[model samples]
Target chain A: MSRLSDLGEFGLIAHLEKILPGGVSKEWSVAIGDDCAVRRSSGGRSEFLTQDLLFEGVHFLPGNSKHWETVGWKALAVNLSDIAAMGGEPVGAVIGLGLPKRAKLREVEALYRGLARAARRFSCPVVGGDTNRSRGGWTLAVTVLGETRRRPLLRSGARPGDSLWVTGELGGASLAWRAERKGKKIPAAMRRRLLLPTPRLEWGGHLAAFGEVGAAIDLSDGLAGDLGHVARASRVGFDVDLETLPRPRGFAGLCERVGVDALEAMLEGGEDYELLFTLRAGAEKAFGDYARSRGLKVARIGRARRGSGIRWFENGREIPRRFGGYRHF
Target chain B: MSRLSDLGEFGLIAHLEKILPGGVSKEWSVAIGDDCAVRRSSGGRSEFLTQDLLFEGVHFLPGNSKHWETVGWKALAVNLSDIAAMGGEPVGAVIGLGLPKRAKLREVEALYRGLARAARRFSCPVVGGDTNRSRGGWTLAVTVLGETRRRPLLRSGARPGDSLWVTGELGGASLAWRAERKGKKIPAAMRRRLLLPTPRLEWGGHLAAFGEVGAAIDLSDGLAGDLGHVARASRVGFDVDLETLPRPRGFAGLCERVGVDALEAMLEGGEDYELLFTLRAGAEKAFGDYARSRGLKVARIGRARRGSGIRWFENGREIPRRFGGYRHF
Candidate 1:
């Protein structure tokens, strides 16, 4: 029998998808392999459903290394990113929690407070959930229900001539994680970006509504890995200029202090929770204007090509792939 | 700081509900307190969403006591029961899985096969989900989306004198559990009841369509505990007769061999996945006809009263509470 380590996370998902039934209902417009599953609802709106699971040791440390509130924020934040990736507005969420029997009520209360804060911030209500005792460590599984007036964004719609764009800066989360692992203090701004990622719902909504965006995905799995998903799904190749990648504030200084490569950090850092999308060639000018009006900074860093797979370029030279984002298995 | 054991499972839920936001969306009709959250959808059908979490050591014994496929079946079956309680037809579902790094691909495949089996049986498609490696034991969280053309049933609708009815038999699950814990052989029928429970979707749909069913809930937490939920929600009391409670086939023999009280086993046995509902007095005859025609056995177990709280009686004599069902904390 093959082990899960041999298949890895994506391979396991693909294997399961083959064995599981799909499109059993006519309502399902988009099923598995997307950021969110889309169903055709009434009133010309599409209902989007997405879920994410976070474990104590796999996703975050449980004890003094992380605050319970930040842990709670991250659990819901990841699901929100999924919604944002699909260009939908979240309406409600259900949290399925599994905690150790020895967990304290005060800690659980604090965790909910953080969750509540995020819910209110995103206008997504916590509608229902189930809680159970776990003999293992903590597990938080959140499912977000959302809707969109326009067609939900997908990773398979990118055209060959489309320009790839990214919202906000990256690499801060990876730097903060490295610092935390070394017992070094993380900057307040970097820590917030790492622990409490803000899902770009407003920006994604504009992109989807404007009708010029090609494909979109969230940068939860780092630039290289997530872009690879879009490339594979869209059947196109990407030539990303490494120098054009936007770095977070003080990111270069943090990389120097932490003894990490800045370009590698920007390329392979995970958990940024920013939106990476493709736009038509001339749509970039209109998009830039709209983003500027909204006080949002978006960078055009790459272009989709006729071939397949993602390749990195620096100063007109190709950079060999050496590192990627976090792997579950 | 109060420990989770101090509040127990229900108390912890109550505490979290107080802190969590409820009904922030205009679409939410029923939130937080029911088997599923109901939302007014566009096509006049009410959408219902419910989730359940199962832990490895707390919910089942991983390798020795149960097969991986049974574990997956139980995880999805419990969520289907919630949809059945709300009298809705499941359209789609998302499963969030947390597995240890050492998990085998063959075991995972078997688990998905069980999930696929239940999905086919109920016609609820497995749409989307997230999977990650866990440092602790295995965890499965399932969220089901359902819809009903009739008004969704709630636990708050039972009026005084409404007849309490239950679909199918109980006690087999608890008996099977005890035998498994003691490493004794479980009867084939009991094992099926314990491992592969069938959700009462058709009966629940009829009850909802008939429009005479009052309050409803699934028998996941035993007769006594789940009835308490309906009583508290409806602000009515229940007088349950121990004699009328339906026992599974060969239940008496199993109880004698297991050294368990038959009454306690019938009342406190959980994970039965049966539907417990209240019917208007005269509606019982029609319900009985429908059930009989469908080859389903439903028993009128009790009636709702004017006061609150649930009480057990035996042939006009009151029986004091001896035990309740499983507690998470």
Candidate 2:
């Protein structure tokens, strides 16, 4: 029998999907394969549901490597990112926690404090959940429920003429990850960006309600892989200009210090948790102004074109798709 | 600092609750501390959400001991039971899975087949979820979304005069568990009761719509523990008649074979997935008749009183509470 490592994460998902009974319900607006499952609720509104699981060793390490609080924050933040990707207002979340038998009460408390911090910051309360003893390692599974007044943003909504835009800069998470690996102290700002990613709730809500953005997805699996998802779903091609991609402050210096290519980090690093989307023509200036007003960064880096596959250009030369970002397996 | 086992499961939940902000929302009809969290969705309908997690070694043992298919069935069935407790129709579900690196693709397929079985039986489609690599054992976390047109049955709604009723038999799961512990082959029927519990969705819906059952909960954490939850939530006392408790066919023989007490199994055994509910006085006959017509067993075993604490009785004598049931910590 083929092992899970051989199938890889995405391959396993596809295999499981084929064996599962129901695909999409007629009552649901969107189902499996989206950032969030969307169903029409009572008040002519759309309800979105998403779930994510984070496992120790696979997602993060305990001990001095990472704080339990930061682990908890990222656990919930990933789910919140799914809701934000759909332009939905998160209402509540249920967390299913599996802790090792030897876990300390203080560590659990610290984790809850981190979860509470994120909950309050996003106004999405931690409502209810289940907890159990784990004979193995710790695991945190978070499920978030949200609602949208308008139609939810979908990765399949991008059109050929739409310009691709991204929120915030990339490579900071990669920098922090490298720093942690090298036993070097990471800057607080970089660590926060890596550990406690802020889901663009307000920005996504505004875009869904007023902005002319078409398709949207969260950058949890780096720009290349996530953009590939949008491209595949929308059945369109993308031409991204590497020069136009936004970089964090001191990004070049950080990459140089780590002996890595800055452009590679921006393209292939995961856990950025920024929003990647497509905008209508002539809407870039307005969107940029809105981001400036809100103290958020918006970068226009690519455009959807009539065709298939993602092509990259760095200073007028096509860059081959060498890597497809992070893979869990 | 104290360890998690020092606090125990319930105590840890209470501790976490105190530190977490935003307990209840005005917009939510029901928040935490229930079988499921409920909120009013658009179009005058109530939406219910509940989550559960199952961990290997903690909840089950894979490989030669237990079938992965049965594990998948129980994982989804537990969540379905929560929806039944709320008297709601399950709309969809999201499952977050964590698998060890050595997991086989065939085993994963078997697990999905079991999940598909339950989903088809309950009409709750597997809509969306996330999967990741696990450094430890496997974990399955499921979140179910459901809707109810009528008022949801809450654990806090039982009145002073309500009669407690349970659908289906108990003790079968305990018998199966004992058999497994003894390394003896469990009866196929008993094994099915333990591993593939049927959620009482129809009965719960009927009770919610017409039978006047007030408070309801699914039997997961034994009769003693779950009934205590109802008593505490409703602020009422319960008087349970031990003699009136329903037992599975050949339950006495199985208990005798396993060298266990049948009564203890009935009171302290868990994973029954039976619906434990309270009906208004005079509604028993109608409810019983409805259940009979539907070929289901309904046992009236107790009553709610105007006080706190859960008390047991046997033949006009009070039976002191011996054990408080299973603790995760």
| lDDT for predicted candidate 2 compared with the true structure | 0.86
RMSD of each: 1.9, 2.0
A-chain TM-score of every model: 0.96, 0.95
Note the B-chain TM-score for every model: 0.95, 0.95
Off by over 4 Å in 2: A64-66, A285-296, B64-66, B294-296
Angstrom error of the Cα, residue A95, model 2: value is 0.6
Model 1 chain A, poorest ten-residue lDDT window? A57-66
lDDT of 2 by residue, A1-329 (tens): 67788887878888899888856767777878889999876667888999998888888788632488888788888889989998999999999988886677888888898899889899888988998888778888899999988879999999998999998888888778877788777578998898889998887887787558889999988899999899989999999999998988787887777777777678788888999999987787787777788776688898999999889998889977565868988
Deviation from truth (RMSD, Å), model 2: 2.0
Instruction: For candidate 2, give the DockQ.
Output: 0.78
